[model samples]
Target: MHHTIEVEDLYFTYPDGREALRGVNLTVPPGVKMTLVGPNGAGKSTLMLHLNGILRGEGRVRVAGMEMNEENLPRIRAAVGMVFQNPDDQLFSLTVFDDVAFGPLHMGLPEADVLLRVETALRAVGMSEYRNRVSHHLSMGEKKRIAIATVLSMHPEILVLDEPSAGLDPRARRMLINLLKGLDMTMLISSHDMPLVAELAEQTAIMDNGQVVACGPTAQLLADHALLERHGLAP
Candidate 1:
């Protein structure tokens, strides 16, 4: 079976000689919603950066059947939609419509097609009513949804998120969780929120010291208290 995302023997290091990923390997099958959980400095974010060619590292990273390379970056980025932990990082346009339309516009799509994509994406995130509103004025929950809408307009095959539940309150977190549950694309989310992981992921991979230490069904992994405790996921 073909994988939607594949990382094999990945290795990455910062300029200061700090290793962020070491021989990491992971795979996400098509249409799978998987979560990567681990303590701080586990290289989850580092690994995510490689998904869209934001941070080139030593290893074979493939997404939607395309290998990571300078020549393939444009196509690869179009295939993988990355949602950062901070919604602010993703939304910059004055209006929610423009923010969501940026990707399709850049793709040189027709005006009608761009409008359609923007509308479809906003509807998908349940933010269609806020299309004309200022992106920066919305609440955190609203912003998160809009951020996702911006990515959805690109029509990516894979959705990669980093710490999606990071600063959200309970209500916003719940909303975010529901929003994620409704997305049908392949997803690889890096989050510390175990409950969110349990709710959204069918599969889970535990990362530590820059490597994937374990991978299995969410229920099986979450049931392992000793493993969770050892990895600082549970007390």
Candidate 2:
């Protein structure tokens, strides 16, 4: 079977000698949606970094059948689109349109194609009207949408998101959920939002101290309060 992402015996550590991941082995099939639910220090963000070769770790890590290395960095990055926790960090251009068009331009696409991709990506996230607006002037929700569009312009096959729902009100959260649901890419979302996981993911993995403690169907994991509590996902 073809897998979109593969992680085997992966290990990562910070510069300060803090171990982040310990022997993590994970495989994500093409087009599958998975959620990673873990505590603040469980290394969810660290693991996401490895998906696109941002932070290399020990052992094998692959995306879209390509191994993570300097040889495959460009291809791997084009295949894995990561939406960071903060939109401000992702969208840095002066105008929203420029921010969304940056990725395609960096990939060396033609002017016409780059503009077309920018327009399509913004429309996909329902933010086409704000294309000319300044990135710094947009609200949190709008910024988040533009961030997604920025990556979407690259036409990534795997979409990795970290805390996509953080700091959003109920309405904006729902809107973001709807936007995600409409996409057709393989999604790997790391969030603490139980309801969002239950609504979107078929599989869920709970991690602690950089290790996966439990992984199974989303419904099964959510149904077990004991397991949830063990992972600090429950009150």
Candidate 3:
């Protein structure tokens, strides 16, 4: 299998002396949909950052067959599109169209190609009509959709999202799930919502104290009440 993502004994420590990731190892093969669930401070964010070369650490981290290093960062980031936990961080342009077009534009796409990518991305996220809307004025769910569109325009091989449905209502959350399901790229999602995880991911991994304690089929992990409760994922 072509593993789009791979990490072997990955470890990270904050400047303040906190070890956020400890000997973490994970693999997301092509076309796999994996969800990561864990208690707060379990290094979920740290690990996700490493995937796109946003944060470098000890050991091996590879995205789209390229090692996570200064030299490979640019290509790795292009291959792995990351939608942050905070939509505000991802959506900075004044207009939704601008925000969605940001990546493609930076990649030096022509004006026509950039606009086409923006439109296609918005359509994929069900936000086509809101392209000209002011990004800051949009609702939380709308902002989330636009943030996703921003990454989708890059045509990444793998989509990585952190807390995707964090603040959405049930109806909006369901719609987001459907939107994500329609995408063909491999996905790496970190979320506290068990139901969303169960529905979106074919594989699930439980993290605790900076380590992935368990990983298996989503159905089996979701059904193990005792295991989840132990890891603070009880639903």
Model with the higher lDDT, candidate 2 or 3: 2
lDDT of 3 by residue, 129-208 (tens): 99899999998899999999999999999999999999998888989999888898899999998889988999988889
User: Poorest 10 consecutive residues of model 1 by lDDT?
Assistant: 226-235
For candidate 3, the per-residue lDDT at 50 reads 89
Candidate 1 regions with alpha-carbon error over 4 angstroms: none
* Per-candidate alpha-carbon RMSD to the true structure: 0.9, 1.0, 1.0
Error of 1 at 86 (Å): 0.9
Name the TM-score of candidate 2.
0.98
lDDT (CA) for every model shown? 0.93, 0.91, 0.91
lDDT value, residue 79 of candidate 2? 90
Which one wins on lDDT? 1
Residue 168 of model 2 has an lDDT of: 89
Q: What does the lDDT read for residue 139 in candidate 1? A: 92
lDDT by residue (38-111, candidate 1, tens digit) is 99999999999999999989989998898999899999999999999889999999999999999899999999
- lDDT at 198, model 1: 91
Runs in model 3 deviating more than 4 A are: none
Task: Identify the superior model by lDDT, candidate 1 or candidate 3.
Answer: 1
